[model samples]
Target: MRLSGERLVEYGEKGGCFVKKMTADDIKDIRELRELLEVGALKILFSKNNKQTIKELELICEDFTSMVEKGYYGGACEADVKFHEKIIEATGNERLLQIYHNSNIPLFHLKLGNALSHMDDYKQTDVEHRRIVDYLKNGKLKESIDTLLEHLDRGEKESIEF
Candidate 1:
C-alpha cells in the first residue's frame, strides 16, 4: 500500500509505523491535485475526441449506473474512477497517464478509506456523468469542463463530509 502511494502507514518520529488517519486536508489536497491534472488534460482530450471515445465513456457511465442501481457503492466508485481515467487516457499522453496512476487518485476515491465511496445520492452523479458525455459528444468543451468541475466539486464536498 505504501509503495502504491496509498500511504496507509505513517512512521512515527521514533521510527515505529502505524496506520495513518486520513484527514479533510489530505482529501482536499488529493482532490485539488486531481482537478489540476484532469482539468489540464481536457484540451488534449477534446482534440482526440471521437464517437468511439464518447462511446467508451458512455459505457462507463452505464456501468456506473448499473452499479449504483445494484446498491454496490464500491463498484460505482470503481466505475467513477474508470470514467475519469478513460477521459485522461484519451489524451494519449503516456507520461500524464502514468502520473495520474502514480498519484493514486483512483484509490483515494475508492472504498479503501471509505471517504468518497458512500455518496448519499447516486442519481445526481449519473445525471452529471451523462451530461458530461453529452457535452463532449456535441463538441462543447467549455460545457464539458464546467460539468466535470461540478462533478468533482460534489465528490470533494462529500468526501470532506465523510
Candidate 2:
C-alpha cells in the first residue's frame, strides 16, 4: 500500500533511476489508446499542437541534464529515448506512451551502444537542459519549449550544435 507522503524518489535512487519490479496492482491496460495515439503522432496529426509539444520536450531535457550533472549516465535506455519518455509524460499523451512501450523502445535501444559512447556529452546536455527548465519555470514556456524540440531533433541527427 502507498503510505502517506510516499515519494517516487524513495522507490529509486537520488541520481540513477531504475525500473521497479511491478505487480498486477501497479499495471493498467491501454493498448487501444496507445495504438491510437501512436498512429496520430506518426501521421503528424499532433502537428497542430506544436507549442504544447515543445514545452513538454523542454521538461524532458531538464531531467536529463539533472541526472547527468549528478554524474550518472541516466537510465536503462539511451539518453535520448529515456529523455523523450519524460517528454511523452509531460505531454499527457497517454496513447503515445503505448507506442513507446510497444515499438520505439526497441528501435532506440538498438542504437543505444552508440548513445552510451556519447555519455561524455552529458555535461553540455545538462546545461542545455537546465536552461530549458529555467525558461519553463520562469514563464518563458514558448522559447524553452522550442529549444527542447530543437535539442531532441539535433540529438536524433547526432549533430547537436548546442
The number of the candidate with the highest TM-score is 1
Q: Which window of 10 residues has the lowest lDDT sum in candidate 2?
A: 22-31
lDDT score for residue 148 of model 2: 59
**Residue range 1-92, candidate 1, lDDT tens digits:** 45425676787899887867768788788878888888878778888766788899999999998998888887887888888888888888
* For model 1, the run of ten residues with the poorest summed lDDT: 111-120
The TM-score values for the models, in the order shown, are: 0.86, 0.44
Which stretches of model 1 miss by more than 4 angstroms? Answer: 1-6, 12-18, 112-119
| CA lDDT, every model vs. true structure | 0.80, 0.47
**Distance (Å) between predicted and true CA of 46, model 1?**
0.8
Encode model 2's per-residue lDDT on 66-110: one tens digit a residue. Answer: 655565563423454654455455456676666566643434333
lDDT of 2 at 134: 61
The residue pairs in collision within model 2 are none
RMSD of each: 2.6, 12.5
lDDT of 2: 0.47
